[model samples]
Target chain A: MSKLLIEDKEVVIPGQILAEGMDYLPSNGAIREGDNIISTSMGVVSLSGRLIKIIPLTKRYVPQIGDVVVGFVKDLTYSSWFIDIGYSNDAVLSMKDATSDFIERGADLTQYFSHGDYMVAKIANVTKTKAVDITMREPGLKKLYGGKIIEVNPARVPRIIGKQGSMIKIIKDSTGCMITVGQNGIIWLKGPDLKNELIATEAIMRINECSYTQGLTEQTEAFLKERTGGKQHGVHQEA
Target chain B: MAYTKRLDGRKLDELRKVEAKVGVIKTAAGSAMFRMGNTIAYAAVRGPREVFPRSMAKPDTAVLRCYYDMMAFSGAGERVRPGPSRRSKEISMVTAKALEPVLDLTEFPKSGIDVFIELIQTDAGTRCAGICAAALALADAGFSMKDMVCAVAMGVIDGTVVADLDKAEEDYDKGPVADLAMAMLPRSGEVTLMQMDGEASQEHIIEAVELMKKSIKKIYEVQKKALLEKYGGVKDE
Candidate 1:
């Protein structure tokens, strides 16, 4: 195994052997001199023994091709809608990419999409200039309506949605709000009362803040009960 | 009448609540989030990459490119779209200039430094906050630099020079509102970045600059403390 430097700092980026005789290996961002492993990166270093890595304290959202994301309509043309996807530029959603069905010309474009409307889309392509072209022609991608929208840090959206949609499923089961999250930081929620909408919003915000914690489902359930003055219905009670 | 009144009940020379956190982004070379009261800015610095647009490359120094953006929701009621507007471009250019003086650019010949700052929340004084956060992130990224750059904004409000103005004070100040933003090299006392907006008498401008110098000194101390805490008092030269 060979040792290398990250940014000129002595760090053992996975697959580097620090010692010749011992099974113990230095973690990522760590220096192994003798039996001890020293941190070479400026972050909370984690060690799996298999390979140590540096876990960054902050998060940033980077768009990827073929990933489904929610976006907000900012500008409209006769043929397409310009969507703001929290990137350096707006992504285009041509009418052809909106749906496989043919859309009639001058048919009250608002019927298909109005400015400020949020929808789920897939990144079709990214140009050399980094301009992203998006399409709604896929399963589970469509226009969103009749829900109050809230914005959060784009980087935290995945955590807010939770693993395999478990976290969001809980929120939906509890608050009974038809919810949709766009990758661009727009969240849409529709509930019967202003109270339920506010409750759902608070739950999402809390999830965003406390994403690092374990037992998030239980914690969120308890939090919702305390805030709403009653236990949430349909909470998955695991035996 | 209280001699010190600039809304938010802060004194003429008193600063707003200042908070700084390091390592906000996992993918960036280095990152930081800074909040001056309600004005919150996040900065990420990634660098030592091959210079783009080969024509702009210089053999002697690293080219620094900065992008400053305000989140559409940063304002009170208006939602801003993410993109480079004229205002954002101007702020980005000024922020890049502020960081240029402290960086030992000669180290990375034909390379580039990319500093991206996003204003997650804004009340006022965003440009100064962006510069401060970007400088810290660059240091965190392990880039060699001459000194930490600390920035602070002072403004002439109601004929009195106030340090760090918030949104209400910035909007309502009746007198010739002059905003002076400066970035200083703590050890050298060198002004790396300086800019003033609105008209102020030369005397008032000088007074504002003096106030900024003092404020930036305090900011420098904060930067040092944060870095020391992260690296265990190991000074990076």
Candidate 2:
């Protein structure tokens, strides 16, 4: 007989059995044994019909194809710039995908993108050997200049971004800071001044810390309002 | 003469006081501290990131590397010499083997996960303590693991089989003491590590394994509690 060992949204640890019987299918951070579906990470259980998955509380960012990532240029090759997207290996951002500008071979690549330059790019492909390829040709993807970057737990990136960008939208509207959150958990914040950027950073960090709690959006909205103060034009006043 | 009484007054099947806490080191990717009686072990996990020396990087799966060390003042009898000794290196290897089974690093090819286990205090089972701490640290670091690996040192004192061996029992001169450090995957009841020192008969070995099986479950509970407390309070069930 099929049995569900855990309720939806329950916190589970590695090896904890989530369900029994072949009727249930395990996905994500969970795996299937002979007849039992067990968790393979320390995370919360997310149940959807016959599918059972675990949402890990903490995990290293695994770059996937088509993921928008913030990366720092580590080194420059003749035709490519090695980008560190907080992964095990450096990603390759070649000249063709680097920009729309036409360039000659070995034309001093540093003149375009140099060491220590951060850029918001998209993962174009990942080779079988785990070589990552990122691109900056897409709109809204460019080299971030003079903005502060802060890292958060990659797992919390979704919560920081919120439902359809609601949480981030609230923060942006209040602080008037341009916030770019990368799937790799690296955030770029550039505001009119350092104070606004700092406020945005603190709000993002707070969301990262308390991402597991309920009513996070409301808490964040109140927090941004309090920090930015109600007098600011960006701070929305309730009727 | 039969060794009837435990030196520390614990029952033959009873373990030392177990205490565990996760996220002890804020800087580590995952860190935990586990104390079994007087033996205290702190474990920190780093990476699934780039493998150093590049040549050592695996193309299909991530490498699990462990470093086991005992602090100078942690020993009960004498100060432990700093640096990686032959004993430490062996322990480190066994530790990696014990934890490698549950970890699924296939998703992270060309990466390396390093587990650093340090004994802050020692009373007999330092390696076992380190293993326990490292398992918890790996889980905390959010690595995919099949199950938590629990370890404990079971010893045969004279004719009696005991659960957790303390320093005094290890040093008991009145009887032949045989130390057996074992690690097991609790759910599967699979023994991942079994290293015996001194001497033991077939009957004594069987008895020690039985005691270990029972004690391992208890250790698993403690490890589970440590992880749950850090992530969220224990759910009623």
Candidate 3:
């Protein structure tokens, strides 16, 4: 009799058989091979009910709608700003999406957003031809200034934020730094001091390296306490 | 004629030592260098990134590109010369076809994954080494696939089926030689690549394929062990 050939969280290689006959239907990272279900990639398996899928250990970011990304300004068009969001083609940020204020046509769009500037924006739309449109006329979305940006794995962003913003909030409270996290794996932070900034950066790096490990939040918390020299500044206990 | 032994002193079915050194290139997305006896090849995988030339980008899947080259200093004795030779170009196409069956290109959709394999040293079975190393590098890059492909070559010498053909035994001008290369899914018994050179009888071909099937299981162990060393945390080690 055929059964689920792999256990939950089992690592599998491509073409490795997952099941025989029709006992189970194949899911992502697995395909039907003759009468058997076979894995077509290297990944950690996740079994949900009858559905079995594989999640890769590491992968490049593929754009999805509503993902807030940190992108570099590539060029300025007459009606829009072209941004490179790590894709092959440029994502367009139209002038109308940039500001509420109306400006005369061809009245220096660069005055609002120029080339080489980084911004945290949402992907408003992506077309069949891969044309993308972004918007910044939303709260907490704007042209970033006077801060250093760091890129992390997009998949691990949720872990960095922790459960209900627990991990990032701890880092923010410790350093007393302003930190904005973009879903595209771009982190913006301005710590009180360069040393504080370095500590926060290192903390994120730690998360990126070990996101799969258990007890990551506590480890990150301990890491922050140790890195800040244990001179705990209780910011949330404000009178 | 009673047979003595292989020139390298290995048994008819014995394979050479295999070492898979992964994450060798720091800059490439993923890379590995594999050595089988005297043959060594390095493979680097890049992208699932933007599709180039626009038209080549598939609306429903990703494209797989490969470049297999032998460095001028790879061969023994005199320099083999630089740039893509006719033989290298043919091998490039051959390697690409072999990898196509393994990669689930539809996952990336319009992007491309390029696998570059460089022959660092040669004895025999360089293509086999290259294909094996490329699979590891692709796994290191994290592309979705059915399975990693392991390759090995079989030859009939002195009326015996030998596992891996080294340089001395693969001489083309030599009499009564049958060199067949096979790349397969070790777990499923699916063939992704099979090429035969030199003259051989049908019986020898059938016998050689059986030998290849058994030997690649050993190569599969090596490939899996190498990947686990780097990504052991994801799966149970």
Each candidate's root-mean-square deviation in Å? 13.1, 2.6, 3.3
Q: Point to the candidate with the largest TM-score.
A: 2
Tell how far residue A92 is off in model 1, in angstroms. Answer: 0.6
lDDT of 3 at B143: 71
What TM-score, to 2 decimals, does candidate 3 have? 0.88
Scored on chain A only, each candidate's TM-score is 0.71, 0.95, 0.89
Off by over 4 Å in 3: A21-23, A128-130, A231-239, B1-4, B51-56, B107-109, B172-174, B233-237
Categorize the docking of model 2.
medium
Better candidate number, 1 or 2, judged by TM-score: 2
Give the number of the best model, judged by DockQ: 2
Every candidate's chain B TM-score: 0.92, 0.97, 0.93
Model 2: lDDT of residue B26: 83
Model 1 Cα lDDT, one tens digit per residue, A92-128: 9988898777678776666788998888788999764
TM-score-best of 1 and 3: 3
- Candidate 2 local lDDT, B118-152, one digit each (tens): 99899989899999999999998888899999999
DockQ of each: 0.05, 0.78, 0.48
> Model 2: per-residue lDDT, tens digit, A1-239?
89999999888999998899999999999999889998998888888889999998888888899999999999988988999998888899988999888898668899889999999999999988788999998887888888799988888999999999999888888877778899998998888788888888999988877678889999988887788885354553221
Superposed by TM-score, candidate 3 places the C-alpha of residue B232 at a distance from the truth, in angstroms, of: 2.3
True contacts reproduced, candidate 3: 0.52
Query: Please, what are the lDDT tens digits per residue for candidate 3 over residues B1-237?
Result: 533477788989988999897779866777998899999999998876777687988887777888888888999887988668898888888888887887766546677788899997999998899999999998777677677889988888766788899888887343566788888888767888889886678888888888888899899988887876665543453
